[model samples]
Target: MLFTKGGDGKVIPRCRIKPLSAKNVVVEGRDIDVQTFLKVYRQRVHGLRFIFDKNVRRRSDLASEFEGRIVLTLKIASSGEVENVQIKLTTIAENSPFSAINEDVKESVSHWKFPKTKNGATFSFPISFYMMLPQPSMFDDSSSIKNK
Candidate 1:
């Protein structure tokens, strides 16, 4: 998804998600090719996101609502275990609501798994969170209707 801040009261995401470089993908011991592994790895990681929302709500560091990009670099072992997850870049600030999402993001990343390969692989991907902003009422006197 791509995002661009709009001057005319609109929000369009303009971010690009790049697949892992072929040279970075390895499947020595496994029977699958690099392309197939990449597909599977992506699917697995996206599926893991379902579990993140539930865990994130428990935290109160900040209200987790923002429209921006968060890129994460991950290293996976040959045994399908995630070795590391690092914040490559983020358009949102840490003091913002994104801080509340940090633990949930880590928790989600930890659950990502892939088939065992002869050697582990390292790659990066971006996850975008977006929502529409609330607009003010069209009429200023609308509140007077209820007051009467």
Candidate 2:
């Protein structure tokens, strides 16, 4: 999801949700369809950018040593609340700093709130994290760096 800050300093979804299936409404007993569920959700959820921004620090600290991605699956209530969050995949070593980052991201996302609806929804998305060092200034030729 793309996020932009609102005038009140809240995170807002850049894109609205598209049309969704209504058949699941009857099966799930939810009043809203998938798109409606997501549209409402995207509007209310906040602090998502925080999770992505934090990755920059993680990258600087562990960039040369490791890189990783976490696939998160969330269960959202119709009331615009997060019911559950799970890490579906990760490449960080179990005891590494990236592992801690993974857990931190999951915990942060769990506390997120979505748009309320009559029925809860389940969705999966991937968040990839990595870091790199800044290159030297092009004008500084004294260091004599070779062209790769």
**Per-model TM-score versus the true fold:** 0.52, 0.56
**What is the per-residue lDDT of model 2 for residues 10-83, given as tens digits with 9 covering 90 to 100?**
33322212223333222233444556655643553334435444543444444444445666677777776878
TM-score of 2: 0.56
Q: List pairs with backbone clashes in candidate 2.
A: 78-116, 78-117, 79-116, 80-114, 80-115, 80-116
Question: Candidate 2, which segments miss by more than 4 Å at Cα?
Answer: 1-61, 138-148
Least accurate 10 contiguous residues by lDDT in model 1: 55-64
Please give, for residues 1-148, the per-residue lDDT of candidate 1 as tens digits.
Answer: 2223347744332212244555654333333356765676577544434333333333322212434566777777878778788877777667754464555666677777677867777766666654432234422346665544
Superposed model 1: Cα runs more than 4 Å off: 1-34, 41-65, 132-148
lDDT of each structure? Answer: 0.54, 0.54
Candidate maximizing TM-score: 2
Candidate 2, residue 17: the lDDT equals 21
